[model samples]
Target: MNSNYSAQEKNFATALLHNLWKYLLLAASIVATVKIIFFGFDIDE
Candidate 1:
């Protein structure tokens, strides 16, 4: 029973981490796009 509980806890943690990274990547891309739109970026300069 304890092992089963631990397994379930680990699964939940894995899912949480997965979602966290997904959202973080999504947010980072959005922020980058907004920054580029508003402030612009210069690679050649």
Candidate 2:
């Protein structure tokens, strides 16, 4: 029950996983910047 992925399928799956990681990193950075701008706009202390 664990032998159904061919070489092409494996490559595609690996590429998809890598692409997901890249997008997640980009999203995280964007969210962090937005949060800081909204909550820490006044840094006098």
Candidate 3:
């Protein structure tokens, strides 16, 4: 039972980390887009 619980917890942690990275990247892209649109910041520059 203990081992099973540990495995489940590990899986949950992995999923949470994955989701965090996904959202972080999404937010970064949105911010970059907004900057480009309003401030004329070049992404390549």
Model 2, range 1-45, lDDT digits (tens) per residue? 345567778989999999999999999999999988877766633
Write down the RMSD of candidate 3 (Cα, Å).
4.5
Model 1, global lDDT? 0.91
RMSD of each: 3.7, 3.3, 4.5
Report how far residue 9 has shifted in candidate 1, in Å.
Answer: 0.3
What is the per-residue lDDT of model 1 for residues 1-45, given as tens digits with 9 covering 90 to 100?
699999999999999999999999999999999988767546434
Tell how far residue 36 is off in model 3, in angstroms. Answer: 1.2
- lDDT at 45, model 3: 50
**What is candidate 2's local distance difference test score?**
0.87
Candidate scoring better on TM-score of 2 and 3: 3
Ranking by TM-score: 1, 3, 2
Over 4 Å off in model 3, which ranges?
A: 41-45
The CA lDDT at 30 in model 1 is 100
| Candidate 3 residue lDDT tens string, 1-45 | 699999999999999999999999999999998887866555445
TM-score for each prediction?
Answer: 0.80, 0.74, 0.76
